[model samples]
Target: ENFFDFCIHSSGESEIKIKLFFISWHPLIVPIDEIYANETGTLTVCRFYTKGSLKDYIHQTKPTNSAYWKRYGRKSLSRVCDLNQIKNFGRQILEALNFIYDNGLVYGHLHSGNILFDLDQALPIKLLVGFVYNLYF
Candidate 1:
């Protein structure tokens, strides 16, 4: 259903690979949400975006020549959107970026996959430059 539901209903999720996923704040940036963890690790949760990531929203197919082809995989999907929707998305992006920069904070990891269409609360700052561009490039 929704990202929140997905995270909560993940059954038995237990991992803490991404550090940022645990502690984050700000309206534009995905916030560190609810959960419990122990010595094993944290329940890393990224909200389920109905709109998906910006890359997912735009690209019809995975990048064939991309080094991350293995990760993105090869798939054909259809996108449904209009110019006005695109414009609104752009505005929201700018607002998010401004918020990050204004706070003297940097989005260490910036990429299409790093950006989700629904920017309410889920996912945030991360590592790996290649993993950065690699995630959704």
Candidate 2:
């Protein structure tokens, strides 16, 4: 069975309540199932989406110092930088962070890699979505 499904099945009333509270207010943040490690352990498993992250896209488009000018010519890359896109990215990230902090949870592993980008064809531009946990941290 899925880890989240298993969590929902096994979680106590308090755990369910907290999960519901977080989900209700922050629809963008997907909560994974809370798994217990063994009969008594601090570790838990939380599975998240496999969507492509912002770092992936940024890396794809990153230009070498020389390629920077070669691709767009002598003109600075700033000329091609879309202000609206940058603003939207910042706004969404801030909103996500604010929501997490408001819940008294610290999002320690924040980075472009953690920010998933929605690349659905219907959307006008890329949209930064939720993040997955970094176990290394």
Candidate 3:
């Protein structure tokens, strides 16, 4: 249910289109479904996914033109969280970083937008969603 607005170049020539899908296993990555570059290039696009850079999480106010609209009230994602939830999310992020480091890879980008929450389940699940800035050893 996500669409990436970026494209990749193959052999520094043709542009490659990539499609990714969210998998249920890990909360820090996804899998690329397909890849093609103007019918050329040798770089094989494997089953790869992107991880996000978690910066911060907070209830943000939606812009409503002026103070009049703001006086009414603001809406937010109705996910009530506790200390345990925050702790769990922290642990998950650490685990993901550990895995990346173990593989001699480093996360180049880290920000709040990179982190995702799967609210479909009873307990919202955290997910990392960007990797274009990752560095592999």
lDDT of 1 by residue, 25-137 (tens): 54555555454554333443554445556665466534332454533555635577689776766666667665544543344456677666543534322221111100111
| CA RMSD of each candidate after superposition | 12.4, 10.3, 9.8
Worst ten-residue run, lDDT, model 3? 48-57
- Cα deviation of 86, candidate 2, in Å: 1.0
Model 3: colliding residue pairs:
51-130, 52-129, 52-130, 53-111, 54-111, 55-111, 55-112
| Alpha-carbon lDDT, every model | 0.45, 0.45, 0.39
Error of 2 at 54 (Å): 0.4
Predicted structure 2: lDDT: 0.45
When 2 and 3 are scored with TM-score, the better candidate is 2
lDDT of 2 by residue, 1-137 (tens): 64434443465434544533454345454444553333222232334434455654454433223353453344433223279878877776777766665554345557765566554533322222222221111
Off-target runs (Cα >4 Å) in candidate 3 are 1-27, 34-57, 60-80, 122-129, 132-137
TM-score against truth, every candidate: 0.44, 0.48, 0.42
